[model samples]
Target chain A: MTIRDEHLRQALQHAPDRLSAPHENTSRAVLSYARQTLEKEQRVWWQSCMMWLKKPLVSNWQRAGVGGLATALVVMLIFWQMAPEKATWPDAFPEHAFNTDKNNAVALMKDKNAAELNAPLMRRKARATGAPAQEQTMATQPGHVIGQGEHQSIALDHSSPATNEIASAPISAPAVVAGANDSSGAMSSANQARGSGSQKTEAASAELSEAKPVKKDAVLDIMQLLDSIKNEGGQTVAARDISLSKLRMLKLDMSTTKQENSAPCLQMATVDASPDMETGYPVLMVSICDSSMQLINGVAEYNQQMQDYWYRQLQKKNNER
Target chain B: MGESITTDEDLMRKFCAGDMRAFELLYQRHERPIYRYIRRLMGGAFNAQADDVFQDVWIRLIDARLQWQPRENASFKTWLYTLAHHRTIDILRKSGREVSVDEGWLDDEPGSPWQSWPAAHALEPEQQVFWRKAGQRLLHCLDGLPAMQRAAFLLHHEDGLSVDEMRLVLNAEFEAIKSRLRYALFKLRACMGAYLPPMVD
Candidate 1:
């Protein structure tokens, strides 16, 4: 629009345009250097570690080792589980030597595991007192027998014809006779034989010669035992005799008598030969019988309170004398 | 590789994408202008120093290939000139040379461009002599101008850069570049007005 603007534009338009060209060598040298650098990076050895990480599948060695370990572990566990355990006795005591009934009797001489032999006793107690087997084990507190005693027997008076016939026949003790009442009465028969026969004979000889130590003057805790029986809901039987030294066998009548009848059945003598808990004492011999004193096959509920009461009375009488 | 029709920016992108052929085309197209820029910025000395700066500008372009992004308004020519301008200034500064922005020192000088003129006519002999004198006087005036003003003038006239694009190339404020170009034109007009061909009326 003005004079200066027109002239200035014309001057800028005619400005010198001289510029020299770049030499040829410089371009070729720089391009080659860059390509070499890229190629060198591609050829490096450490890139293999990255390639290994990028691999998708597991290697064959890993699969074989892991699967083999798993299979061996499973097989070992199955074989270990399938192996059966053998029952072991102490090395000093041979297993076969104690397998006979005689050694079984000796093993039970302490009577600690008399309850293991309690299946027949359980059945007889169930029959006599109408109590459950578990309750019978809780109710009965067994006492030991004094050495060389004249055995007194108790019988349940059953009016059944078969039991009446068994009641009519009586067997002398120190003899092995089959019981007439039931197969479960076989233990009572064996108890009768053992109490009166060879075992008692050997025990009396051992006591007379002082070859065996006799445990005497032990505390008789009949009250706790009677309470356990009374808690079991049974009739309190009375014991007429209290001479524990003269007492030996108890006879239970396992006659097929229904327990609903409330009769004075257990005619046991009250004898206190109770001992310390750790003392291995035998269960007093019990003979199952009917009214005629026939050795009947049975188990009887022993009324411990009546026996303790009578035993205490006898002790009082002996002290007075 | 035919560079006549291809845009500078497209060739820059192709070169950035690792096409060496595109880089060669781009270098050929830009090398002369960038070299002249450096030479003028170096006070018109076409020496080893100027050649080193010239090579450095292209080398910088090659190194920046991975980082180049196509942008709006800033063309490849502007970017190339900017690299040449900065490298030249840096070399000048490192060598402790001051760019003469002082137009006062240029006063009382007679050999300035446009001292005499011959109108465009059928008089061929006088026009050729006038043209040579005009070119020489222009070179002399440019040499006398300040480094930054000369850069602004050259980037504007030689590279055809607008004020904003020259802002990017000069790495300068818009008004600073605008003023520098204005001052540069004023000095050139005051110096070269006499020798320019007369306007055809």
Candidate 2:
């Protein structure tokens, strides 16, 4: 074994070293064969991906077009959800939305007196024709049990309809239209105040009781995100963090720069400097003039310096005279 | 080398976008490593069956269009070895079912038994024949290793997959891959009596 090992080492070194690595013809042939097979089979494999076209969740048509449509739909839906609500200035404000409602809501905010709180919840009581007025009035106010009974009755009667259920369960809470003095009346009144412009609004109203003001941290987070976006995306500085007051106070005589229907939009030709001068900050919409930006304070100081230079030159001439 | 489909991933990317010639380009590029890997894998096992399997491994790769998503975890090399390992296991697991645990050569410098042998410059042709015979014996010793270990050691030595890739190929744990490699080297050293003498002088 020792001699054999020694010889093995010698053979490796002595074998003329083959001048180069193997020609690798077989390797090439096998790989080429594989390539051909792959090319041939790729068609079938790609077909499997599309074979089940009927599944709505996984359709090539859906992937090619429906995915886009679904994405667009989701985006539009999010936009619709995020869109600033168009307030329908009601032709006439509903009677329920009178100042009385606001006052009542604020007053009953902490009031636990059921009777006093329920005062706003008066509803037209069902009565037989020609019933005595006194009886009808008494019937409307059944002290406590009748009110509880009415709640139970409403809950039983108006609960959501159970359809196609194994058991026709009268289980869920009914859509009970509360009477005038009900707490829910105030809630529904609140919902009405914030008009359900769309289903999202209605859903939002349902969640109104649980809603809280936007968190300061969340606002800070959003602002930070926007700042990073600006930094990374090279957005115009004028778009964010520019205190509008600083620019509006420029005291720029409109005639100095005014040419066309140019306003304060951030375009160049729109807010260009005249042959003499134009005093405007870097309105992005405005043309880039020497660094293309200025603050009102900076501009004012620049103007003062220019005036001083002229005045000094005039003073020197007078002294020479 | 015949109409090959040799595209490196970088090349495949160009080809994926309706480049017919891209496929052939990639085949030509990867032809050697892939061929050697298969050739070495099914050494004597190379019959009609192995020919089909070897060809299929390439076909499998091509069909995978795996070049599309060259993932971080499933690397191109790992994926290729993964296919190769599975096929080797399928071929060999039929009889000598014991899993061999290769103990050395996992992650270190190359130290084959041939390293310790006398330099060929000193040897004549007759001595060269003895060295050749010894090399053949080393292969026999390699054959004693577990099917996957032999395959892993050979693949790593020849094909140059990373240790992590070996883990993927073997579907074994990282420590296990390391030890398997260590064991293979230690055994090879023992088998090569010249390198690892039984009674040191």
Candidate 3:
């Protein structure tokens, strides 16, 4: 290096030696400032968490829990509202429902002995005529018992005068003697004569004998049940679960049973149809009654067109017979 | 109190890893030279701006410890001076002052080299007073040089940076850094010789 360059470098290098250093206070302050800044950065995580928790109303987690609970409650309420109502006693055993006897009658005729078949018809006819007839008390019998004193005859004293008049009607020997093969024909003839008002009482007894058995037997069985309870000093029957199958069996038993003529009870009338033997046209027999199981009404006349149709069918059936 | 035998880059790495003691060692090693560089670059710590710029450079160094690594071509000292140089220029510009080194300003009053040469002698009180006066005059002349020249001169002469290192710190081409240093030396020699001439050999 040149003398001038060497001297200039030496002078500039030595010049800084005379200048002042930074104050101790400023060095400490800058270091302290940096530490504070870094310390703040370090705490950012937990500080942010605390900030989130300080939010109004509730935290996000609690809102999720409450939302879940609300959704569950809504689902439960929807299912509850949509669920079916339990069947009430009256609905379970309605006062008037389609009697299933029509469906079972064919089975009964095919299954039972001729004696078993004739017994129910004879008892039903006897009760319908209101003669001094015996009622079968055995529960196995598909017929209702009429209790009167120590004997099993129904007492006619509690009945209205009209009922007493019915009870006092004479039983025709021809009706009592008709074979099961001729019963339906005899019943039809008696019904036709009654339509003319000449044989009303006699014909009504025959037709009603068929009508009252199903519903009246059920009512009488319930009455017989209540009577047994009364005989045991009227203790309340304990509640029990009646299964649907057992209920259906009770319904079948009630429907197949014959009803004796006695006190008033709930009644259900059924229609039976058969093809005329010769004409092969449908013949419909409809039994009519009031709610009291009393034969106060009758299906005397159909449409005039139907009467001619039915008369042709009946005459053809009689000729075939 | 013991000067750390570790290199500046190693100290910086240690500081980045949270060894504050290594940072303090690095600070103590470079603080005086950096403070002087900024002090002379802004005329002195007499101006509050010079102090502000001085502290800013050190704080930047501390703050940048985590990001600092010694590259193949650049030393920690180059990086340190680069930070100080940039901060000085920023303060100077923000204060609305231009940094101009008038190389011709010395030519206007050129005295022959021997006219102000002090006699060669063993170190004496009279020679010390003359050198002290000469040193004060050189510092005053440094203040008048252009900002880039003063920075180049200080990085070269005071911080002992090579021309290539100055290029890195000053962010100028190597030749530009050389020219700035050459011009700075020329002016300081002229200015100081006019005030107190060295004895001619």
Candidate with maximal DockQ: 3
**Candidate 1, A131-204: lDDT as tens digits:** 44553443233322222111111121223333222222321111111111111222233323333333323333
Rank candidates by DockQ, best first.
3, 1, 2
lDDT of 2 at A188: 35
Q: lDDT by residue for model 3 over A102-170, one digit each (tens)?
A: 321210111123335445544554566554543332211432222212111221121344323322332
List, for all models, the DockQ compared with the true complex: 0.12, 0.07, 0.19
Candidate 1 regions exceeding 4 Å error are: A1-19, A30-321, B1-3, B100-104, B108-116, B119-122, B197-201
Question: Chain B TM-score for each model?
Answer: 0.85, 0.70, 0.88
Between prediction 1 and prediction 3, the one with superior TM-score is: 3
The candidate scoring highest on TM-score is: 3
Given candidate 2, what's the lDDT at residue A11?
26
- Write the number of the candidate with greater TM-score, choosing between 2 and 3: 3
Q: Write the per-residue lDDT of candidate 2 for residues A142-253, one digit (tens) a residue.
A: 3322222222222211122211110111111111111111123323322232232334333323342233222222112222222333233322322222222112111122
Q: What is the DockQ of candidate 2?
A: 0.07
Please report how far candidate 1 places residue A190 from its true position, in Å.
Answer: 55
How far residue A5's Cα lies from its native spot in candidate 3, in Å, is 3.0
C-alpha lDDT (0 to 100) for residue A108 of candidate 1? 16
What lDDT does model 1 reach? 0.46
TM-score of candidate 1 against the unseen true structure: 0.42
